[model samples]
Target: VLDRQGLDAFMRQIRSKFESSLIQDEKNERFPGYARRRWGGALKTLLAAIDKV
Candidate 1:
């Protein structure tokens, strides 16, 4: 099992990866804003659950 510090680091890594992908998608101009909204909400929910741990 991961300690608190490890969990925090993992969360930061996950967040960084998510943000980078979102930025890349914006640069590619492939997905629409509505799609991004859906994805962002999903990520937020996932992160919230992680925080509970």
Candidate 2:
């Protein structure tokens, strides 16, 4: 049970982590495409789930 502010903070944290992962994927050479695709899907699903709520 998160209040509105808590929810916003949580979303910001998640977004930051995902953004960091994507940035790292761009910089690293190994499996960059795969990692980016997986994280991209997770980010999309997260946004969709939050929108539903």
Candidate 3:
């Protein structure tokens, strides 16, 4: 039993957090010798590409 306003607010909050994290992660990705193992060097992909130097 959720109200319309309450549901909208909840969704907005979730979106805000998700967008913020995505932005930060992208920023971190644009660097030399950036090592990303688990989550992949960059997102929006099917598999992760490991960087080995």
The clash count for each model shown is 0, 0, 0
Error (Å) of candidate 3 at residue 45 is 21
Clash count in backbone of candidate 1 = 0
lDDT of 2 by residue, 1-53 (tens): 66556666776876777778867877888776666576667768667766766
lDDT of 1 by residue, 5-44 (tens): 7767766766676666656676767564644565566667
Candidates 1 and 3 compared: the better one by TM-score is: 1
Candidate 2: clashing pairs of residues: none
Query: Best lDDT goes to which candidate?
Result: 2
TM-score of each: 0.48, 0.53, 0.40
List model 3 lDDT by residue over 1-53, tens digit each: 34556555655654555456655667686662333332332332222111110
Q: Which of candidates 1 and 2 reaches a greater lDDT?
A: 2
Worst 10 residues of 1 by lDDT: 30-39
Model 2 stretches with alpha carbons more than 4 Å out = 1-7
- Candidate 3: stretches off by over 4 Å: 26-53
